[model samples]
Target: MKIQLQTLYNEYLNIKWKRGLSPVHTEPFEYGLYEDDSADLFLSGHSEATFTNWMSELRPEDPYYGSKPNGMPVLADIFNQLDVYDELVLYYLLFTLNTTMSIHTHNSYSEMNDWMKNYSFFQLAQLNGLSSLNDEQKGELRDFFFFFYLYTHPVNEETLYACSFREQDLIHTKTNIKLEHYFSAFHDHYSENRDKYGEQFLIAPHEIQACEQLTLELLRIIEGKSPKLSMPSEEGLEAVVDLINNVEQMLQMYAKNRTLVFDVMRNFLADPRTGLYRNHCFTMLLQNYASYILYFNFDEIHALVNDFRDTPAWCGIIINKIFTDAIFIHKIMRKNAIDIREYPNVIEFFDEQAREFCL
Candidate 1:
């Protein structure tokens, strides 16, 4: 049965998003597989742009190049599009503790939405008319130590964590992780240091090719059994390895996916290749996703780590690095003269989160 709108809104608070229609709390359900069922009504009445052409339903000017049911105009699907939803979902994740888009910041998520609807076009005009500076000035603007940290200081560092990603194929390929090699290394280390660390390393396949297994066993185990859920390394040992693997995967994806890579490249190219932002951005972004991806990974990890509350320190070294990289992105966007501020929610999110994840 189709769920009611109010009911869905309540469910969103619980991080319950619908499949196909919604862009709600999604995770690494099964590697590359992804789905969300949020009804388009969550964003009802927020559609002001009146874009008929951008809809997914319409045919491109050339039928040979573009075609079919996806060709149908999705005028109502603006907020439903992946790119648009990525921004909001990222925004939802950054500011609030809960996974869903709340009614207000602290006072109310619902009130915030109501207030935003009345936000004037005149105010938007004021923001859009601003001029751009050269790269140096942009760099200054993106500084966390200067802009954000000054804005929210004395929060001091917390625990650290390292999150990483790798495709199963790369683990066996020329990339960083060789297949099964990590398990072996971790096993040897744990075996030798049994007196110092009582932890046991475990391994699982990234891709379970058994179509019969998902419904039959994995669900029962995850839902019924308590699994280990810590960062896996306190000294940045395995975490560092995962970090390296994750970075390699991002680079690989960048090399393979020219569109997104070039979007970043063009942003970087806007400025002179001298600043810290331009130099190691690949590393910077690698660090960012490593932490953010954890949004989806943390609960599973938490369930796994439920038994080990006082385990070794957990600091997100990678999370902090992501902040710096994001600042660089915002700086470059400013330097290159993009109207990113119009997307305040996105800018604000990157601004608020960049340095704060220093754990």
Candidate 2:
């Protein structure tokens, strides 16, 4: 069944490519179904009105009602004649089309609001054939959805509030309900199944260990300890860099209030690094501590002691070192403030220090 679905999907993509309608080559800004004539090929003889009508049915209260079908009727009928997996594939394709194209249209705002209000994550999952998936396949799908939500959803309250109020009263209420409730439900579902699904659902064990080692290396650099270093994968390095950037941004934003800075720091540090390098947490700790020294006033440094006490023993020691030695703090901050640019420079710096140590 999976093989058949894959074949159909490949065929669909091949057809699109042949017709010069492949999404891969097109700019995302050029992806609207209503705006792009090439997107008509995706409808497979069904009219744009037909697709809209189908979407409208997903939320019966949709403001733009149409006479079209709910699922892609042509493809649905073809796949329905085969196995349920085929139908699932068709639905998945439809869902992708809706997300990638139709949702970009001006008219789609109300339609999307209505649909999100009417459907739970699980219901949408089921509609897309997720219920029939094996545990391994389900885990992969979960990762896709989790990252999609993480990257696409508004990260801050202000943006979320703006999205909540973007349209008509009916849509405003529905959109808020969907965005607010979806993540809670997604977290609950993944949390319950995480153990049974195993570590493959996130980062592999070796990546986690590498991340941990990388964390220690970053901490040593921040502390002026000149520890021996082994290079981590590019992905691990990037994750560490991203953590540093996030911490620096946070510190810059909340530099005025020491308490609020620590609060924000703690919240970011406490988040699980699911699908990230194991040392991700450690990198965050080092970055936050570094940012603290860079941004916080010496007089207000005493407030950080309480916060450090709540962290790991190692983190506590690092925090204490920054608080106690003014000269050491200045030296560390000066060298560490050089922004990490190319990864090879970091590797070379460590390599140079190793030869001096041996001598």
* Global lDDT scores for all candidate models: 0.27, 0.32
Cα misplacement distance, residue 145 of candidate 1 (Å)? 27
TM-score of each: 0.17, 0.21
Top-TM-score structure, candidate number? 2
| Per-residue lDDT of candidate 1, residues 1-359 (tens digit) | 22122233333333321112334432212111113322222222223211111112212232224342234221223223323222222222112111122222223443322222211101111111113233343233223212222122111122000111131121212223322332233224333443553222111122111211222222111111212111112221333223332433433443465244334433433434353222333343333332222222322222212322222211122223334533433433444465543533323333345434321
Per candidate, the number of residue pairs that clash is 36, 3
Model 2: residues >4 Å from true position, as ranges?
A: 1-4, 15-37, 40-45, 49-53, 57-145, 149-359
Tens-place lDDT digits, model 2, residues 1-359: 01122222223333323333344432111222443323321222223322222223222122124554354322233223333322233223223323321222224444333222211121112212223334554343333322222223212332222222122111113223322222223223334454554533343333223322322322222222332221222333443343343433444444556566565445545655433333433433443454244433333344555555556543343443332312223333344463223323222322333223221
Candidate 1 lDDT trough over 10 residues, lowest sum:
154-163
lDDT of 2 at 48: 34
How much lDDT does candidate 2 score?
0.32
